[model samples]
Target: MVILSGLMFIGISIGLIAVKYKEAYIGLIENRTDNLQTPSVLME
Candidate 1:
């Protein structure tokens, strides 16, 4: 269906953009993780 195709295309486009700006995204994630003492804290 056209709607499904459009959704897939948008999803792929967003994924590509994330990959292109992965460093910035990863930096954000790293800052978030820094607040936790360890990765196990995330399981809580």
Candidate 2:
């Protein structure tokens, strides 16, 4: 039970980290696009 709970906690933490990383990555891309004055559709 203890091991299972520990694994669950780790999984949740990883999921949160992944979500945050994705948000940060998208934010960086947006900033770069704005700086370059390029159309955002090009990014897609």
Best by TM-score: 2
My TM-score estimates for the predictions, one after another, are 0.51, 0.77
- As a TM-score, model 2 comes out at 0.77
Please give, for residues 1-44, the per-residue lDDT of candidate 2 as tens digits.
99999999999999999999999999999999886896667578
> How many clashes does each candidate structure show, in the order listed?
0, 0
Best by lDDT: 2
Q: lDDT values of the candidates?
A: 0.87, 0.93
Report the Cα lDDT for candidate 1.
Answer: 0.87
Off by over 4 Å in 1: 23-44
Candidate 2 wrong stretches, greater than 4 Å:
38-44
Clashing pairs in 2: none
lDDT per residue (tens digit) for residues 16-37 in model 1: 9989799888988998788765
The residue pairs that clash in candidate 1, if any, are: none
For residue 26, model 2's alpha carbon misses the true position, in angstroms, by 0.5
